[model samples]
Target: MRLPFTHSKQEPANTRTARKLCWDSRDEYFRCLDRIGVLNPNDPTQKSKINANCANEDAKFDENCATSWISYFKEKRVVDFKRARALEEVNRNVENNQQAKGSQE
Candidate 1:
């Protein structure tokens, strides 16, 4: 996983073990965010919430991941939460439509 052009042998992505640690930390942090009902960790208003609710998990994520990857994960968490909400909405609509049809029959 070592990049040829850079001297990043010490980089997290250069080794599978480091990547695993980053991913695990990211998941832990995101799970904490979920528990706190926070979809956007980078929001200014949410900063205090995150600090209060998930400071330890956030610290682990920051420790394990590279700076570039940390930002990427933060942005991706919002997108993932939105996607899950959309899926739930669509499923609910389908179920309501089916129930309505059943009642009409």
Candidate 2:
């Protein structure tokens, strides 16, 4: 499930090192997920797949990031992936349109 992205001024892990740790763990976990083609970490249907494939990285990610940030980061990853796919589609369409125009000239 995707959560709406939000910007919060109050971050519990405000230190640079803590933020880095969270990001590192998150990246590792997401890499594992990507390998298994799992998008939503919180999805109950994907829990077994995640546990079997990414238990170690998932555990580290949970340990490093705050409880609030865990869900936020997972949801944000899905949202970001979808956004990037949409952007790519838009770019492809624009390129196709330009090519068509050029061919007509």
Candidate 3:
């Protein structure tokens, strides 16, 4: 079966990486759209004024934002995974302790 967004063999199956890339792209697009403000979705007058200047600025901002978001998510996922592992370890230790105590009694 074909996996979702699988580009090539060089790319391994990494949910965190994929999530980061998606988030980054979305952020970039949104930032560009925001700067363009052609369809402000809030103000009407500024829409027309959003010419090349807005478009260009928006595009750059969007790209940066998207990349930043991906990096942020990657870091966040790592931290979350670490925390989960630690919790699992703690739970296992507790369970073992309980079992040991039970055996003594």
Task: Give candidates' CA RMSD values in order.
Answer: 3.4, 7.6, 14.6
Which lDDT tens digits does candidate 3 get at residues 5-100? 544323323477765755665455445655554333224565555544455554443443444453464356557657999999999999999999
Most accurate candidate by TM-score: 2
Regions of model 1 farther than 4 Å from truth: 1-13
As for TM-score, the candidate ahead, 1 or 3, is 1
Ten contiguous residues with the weakest lDDT in model 3? 5-14
Provide the lDDT at 104 for model 2.
Answer: 100
In model 3, which runs have C-alpha deviations exceeding 4 angstroms? 1-65
* Model 2, span 1-100: residue lDDT tens: 4344465423445589999998999999999999999988988999999999999999888888877899899889889989999999999999999999
Query: Regarding lDDT, does 1 or 3 come out ahead?
Result: 1
Candidate models: Cα lDDT each: 0.87, 0.87, 0.54
Model 2 vs. true fold: TM = 0.84
Q: Per-residue lDDT for 2-105 in model 1, tens only?
A: 45646442445647898899999999999999899988888998899999989999988988888889999899878977899999999999999999999999
lDDT of 2 at 43: 89
Using Cα atoms with residue i matched to residue i, what is each candidate's TM-score against the true structure? 0.78, 0.84, 0.39
The clash numbers for all candidates, in the given order, read 0, 0, 2
Order the candidates by TM-score, highest first — what do you get? 2, 1, 3
